[model samples]
Target chain A: MNCEEISELVYDYLNERLDADCAVSFTVHMDGCAECREQVSDLQHTWTGLADLPQEEPSSELKARFYSMLESQQVAAKPRPLATWFQNLAVFPLIPQGLAAGVLLFAGILIGAQIESGENVDELRREVRSLSQRVTLSLLQQDSVSERLRGVRFSYQSAVYDEEVIIALIDAVGYDKSVNVRLAAIDALKPYLSQQPVLNSMVTFLGKERSPLVQVSLIDALFGTNGGETLETLRVMSNDAQVIDSVREHVRTLLEESV
Target chain B: MNVTDVFSDNELMLRVRDGDNVRLGMLFERHHKKLFNFFLHTAGKRQVAEDLVQEVFVRMLKYKHTYRGESGFGPWMYRMARNVRSDQFRKRGNAPFDSANVETVELADERPAPAELLETDQSIGLLRTALAQLPIEKRELLIMARFELLKQDEIASLLDCSVATVKVRIHRAIKELSRIYHQITCEVRA
Candidate 1:
């Protein structure tokens, strides 16, 4: 191999990508050429130095964040109860919207009367909570984004900590197609964050959550949480590469203040 | 051996594409460090490199449908990584390398002679500085070819160029790096 040919083949030669005959030719040329030998040696040294550079382990936070994202994404990918209901309902073309509205209105009136009567107050409260949960879930599953936003608002107003309602809100945060709804859902879930399930779900959602607006809100919701999981989630978010700069800075600030 | 360890990256990615996203964690575990270093060397900023690694995985999920079973998963992943790095560059508009932010690897406690250890550390440091000084494209080429150990054809496919072109670029990049390293050494010595 000539000097020009050696130049073109040196990288392959160093990498052992050269065929046997070519390798022999290249080695023979380098053996005869001091300049080529020096060049190859320098390249090899640099290459070896680079190989010797430490392979950094991304903090446990990366694994935490990744698994959290994967979990959250899996959660989001699951068929939501209310959504599935709507999908099943789609098959029944004869279901009247007006009739559905009438049924809800009548139920509201019945619940109001039960409250007015003031008997079996505990039962009435249970019934009210159930109704509120259903309303939130149904609104969250609505075709209209605004309706879903309203559902998030209703969940916050009702302060229903029912597992069903919380799951719906979590779904909205993770799976809602609209960022506005998702942001609102994060806010709605704030009041329930004291509940471990709610806290855990929110932290997981923050793992792979893409919307900067939603991420900031979730981070805000998670502020003041010094629990092991929340702290770790916040730490990961603060250093997370996928997080937007503003959100990362916000988390970093939160983390600093917490310290 | 764990059953998962036996699955190839392409197989795991195929699972990921077909709605088994949890399998992605396996792939992440397998490749995140290498990807991290690739970004770290190329960007010369630890935090940015970290974020780029995450971005690449996120893109893998986002664009998983684009993955073809016929192509090697390494090249596919690196191609996405290249795009992510390019996007970052475009977004930052020629951000300067932050040498101070480059992470120092902890040397193994092999009990080498003190002078030899110091020389090794100094050479590594000088090489890193020279690497940071190279053009981003050259730096990336060297990192992929050397550090990441991506085959030339893999790089060629990743960069959408011929194997010959990739080889020539790798040669030039190493030469440039060597020149820069020697220049820095001279400056330090003087």
Candidate 2:
């Protein structure tokens, strides 16, 4: 490349963005180019000097505020998760033995339901409801349960075509090892996301998780939940000159009612 | 002492994650000075830098769950601070900040002041004024490299760009600074 061409590439060359052959060419030119060498020196000096700039620390009061916030967050998250509670139940020999004994009872109930419409799905729903109620009642008797069970806490919000499938889906979302499975759970939960806890789960997936793929889905969930707020947040991010505004603009468009 | 024994910022952060408040405090103590200095130079004022530094820590705490254990913590914090500073100015309005935190820089700060600056008499007050005039991208490139003492590779990682790009940005920024410095100094001394 000529001097003019090399001059135009000074930034690229210095940054090592140039191919090895081009860089060698550029270095060879630099050995004879006084002005270009000076330019390189100036950039080097400024970058070198920046590291020494002094900074101010957050005040002790501010640190306390941060500390307290973290303390509460940890306290909130430290609970043995709901899944852990259920997983422990899965290992109970007495419960499994009871389930074995209930097999006869379920057979009788299944026979009765099969006589009505042969809908095993409906029968399973009825059985799950009774079992959950019995468990809740037993806890209530022991004075250990939180005692805040809703009348239909175990009832489905929507007329799920396959309650069994949805239960499996929700279970997979909660405990499946793959992030993709959890993301699919978020996707499946979309139509039935009127409840706040499920919506909170969607937000937690998007805002708290580091996986960018999951983040994109979370962004989609945020768009569905509250586009205006999501747009405003993205707008705030877009304000940084260094940030890629095109990404922000794309997010902004998702908030628009046009499409 | 080895670099790790001197002050392991990474270890301190891990301790903070494990709920060691004292280690968090130590992390702050070790980094706050250097971070504040970077903020001061970039912000061109002390209280604003101090406030921004505090905001950075608060944000760090709030987003601790989001830290992916990928990059070293300081670089990540700097990236956060960079985003915060940019967002803050935007929130205030897209107005170009005219007056600096000039009145608020630490009196004890021994870094080169305009009055104390040793340079060509023509460009004495130019570097500061010129630096303030660059677009945020250009200014940030120069500030992180110059005042923060980040190596080119470190800056590349912080900015999530190749070192070549960082080099190019810094080069252009310095050239612009040199031009702006000469212009302002001639004006001030006129």
Q: Could you tell me every candidate's TM-score relative to the true structure?
A: 0.57, 0.45
Chain A TM-score compared with the true chain A, each model in order: 0.52, 0.32
- The lDDT of each candidate is 0.76, 0.56
Give the residue spans of candidate 2 off by over 4 A.
Answer: A1-31, A37-259, B1-7, B94-124, B148-151
CA lDDT, candidate 1, residue B15: 82
Docking class of 1: acceptable
Looking at candidate 1, what is the lDDT of residue A186? 79
Estimate, for each residue in B1-190, the C-alpha lDDT of model 2 and write its tens digit: 1212423577667766665433454556456766766666566556667777778876776676666546777677788888888887788774433334333334233355465545543242345556667666777677666554466777888888987677667766777776665566668778
Q: Report the Cα RMSD per candidate.
A: 19.2, 24.0
Worst 10 residues of 2 chain A by lDDT: A143-152
